[model samples]
Target: MSSTTQKCADMLCHRNGVLKCSRCKGADPETFYCSPECQKSDWRWHKKFCGKQAYVFDVELLGSSNPKITRKVAVPSWYTFKQFHFVLQYIFGPWQNCHLHTFSFLKELGNQRIRSDFSIRKEILLELCHEGDVEYVSQNWFDEREVKLSDVYEEDGRLRSKIMVNGNFAPLLYEYDFGDGWEHKITFVKSELARAARPLVKEAVGCGPVEDSGGIQGWNKVKEAFAATQPTTEQLERRQWAREVSGLEERYNPLAEPDVIVMNYEGRWENHEEGYREDERRRTAF
Candidate 1:
């Protein structure tokens, strides 16, 4: 009944809670979820920091021809997965909203993958494994929107008694711009029991490729084109367009200073900003 749990965790959603974060209730009785649908939808990023003091995650951009792109971030436990996605997008730049993405959990034993559906209106599809074989278990998957990091993470051996104290759990996969096959591997580095006002970038390495520059192969091509001496007219034009799309004007040299981290997270909540701007525009129009 705390003020924090009085409403759903989703800012866009205003549902009063009948459902709460079961894992968080043991410590903080807040963090209630409106419904299973909301939990499933928000699971990816929320699971990183929910009900904990703080969480450190190591993120690496996958499928890039170059393997140097990576980032380390510290986030407040209460942030939703949707919020986390924006953080990744800012560091990697595409900066613009122009891609489809999904968060997936994969296991190596039998190559099983549990993915969260963007639309959580339907029943969740769970994967059951036995002796390296996998099968789909109906009605067993918890909606991602309703789940939080506290739900999946266990520090005191309460959730998984058999899990060793030092064992590392499965990593999460964040696949952005599916067409470009941009994948990121997220590993839980550590967690603390203190609260954070907001997420922060702890470290950053290597600059990501231009937005929608194909996949690994294409990224390599763009790099080569930029590095070419006496480049062709076509390559020059391509670079110009890339600079605009990437928002990197004179600082577009990847080889010179590629390890910088850009923090522009406010852009993610632009829809909220647009409304106010539009309202002011209407008032000024007359």
Candidate 2:
């Protein structure tokens, strides 16, 4: 993929090189504007869902060598990206849940924009550039604890202006486990009324690679060991190691694909707390 980035989305500066960019708090997290003025001017249309809204994000693991990892999640507009991180842990079961990660809000670029309707026009300059093309500036990084999901959103529950003003909606870049180098592209798919206070996993595909299974490559080896009709000593050891850490030694399937679990917590809201308690009881049962 080319390393080129799109110019800011501000209409006034149609040809002006982008100085800075932010994601929209409105319906599209992929659209961005060049300046705050452009972002605010467009807010009239975006403000509709800025309050008490929720979003469904399509998250896919980037840079995976094999077994594409993806999930569709429903979370409240008020959740901090940090809270959503936990929800991912529940679904993917990252190794020991001990990993370092960061979220980048810059415009989605290159092949990462997989949506068929996704536009590359934002990356193009309609008129000859004149503003002495500003050098690409690095986006500011915030610790998970420092920002809430709503921090990037507007008061009405739209995405924060700072995140969307200077650029078009870009996927929320979440790279986890630096050692494993698992990069996830989190895109805001749609907005809706809040279902409940807790987060939900609407759909999931592909079991998350075992944590620290040597990133994608190691993960592949682990899979082969499990699928092996007659396993090698090394394969058996790796398989056993994964089982011990995940606490699924007894039922861990070497040849089985990850189960497809579709959970809508909103539908089971009344029973969720009890379910959690029961899960805790089982966790301690052993």
Predicted structure with the largest TM-score when compared to the true one: 2
For every candidate in turn, the CA RMSD to the true structure comes to 13.6, 17.8
TM-score of each: 0.58, 0.59
Error of 2 at 186 (Å): 0.5
lDDT of 2 by residue, 1-286 (tens): 1112544445455643333222322333323555677767755644543345677888887755445778887777776665666566555643344555545564544554322222442332211111212122122434454566666654443346545635445446665675666767778777676534566677776667877777677888887888788999998898899887667886776344444443453344335444544654675486
lDDT of 1 by residue, 1-286 (tens): 3344477765667987556556555343435567888877766646655555767889887654454778887765555554566556655644343454555444321222223332331222221211111123333333333444554554542222221234556556666665676768888888764223455667777667777788767777777778889889978876777777677786686544343433424343355335434643664486
TM-score of 1: 0.58
Q: What is the model-wide C-alpha lDDT for candidate 2?
A: 0.56
Question: Which 10-residue window of candidate 1 scores lowest in summed lDDT?
Answer: 125-134
Model 2 earns a TM-score of: 0.59
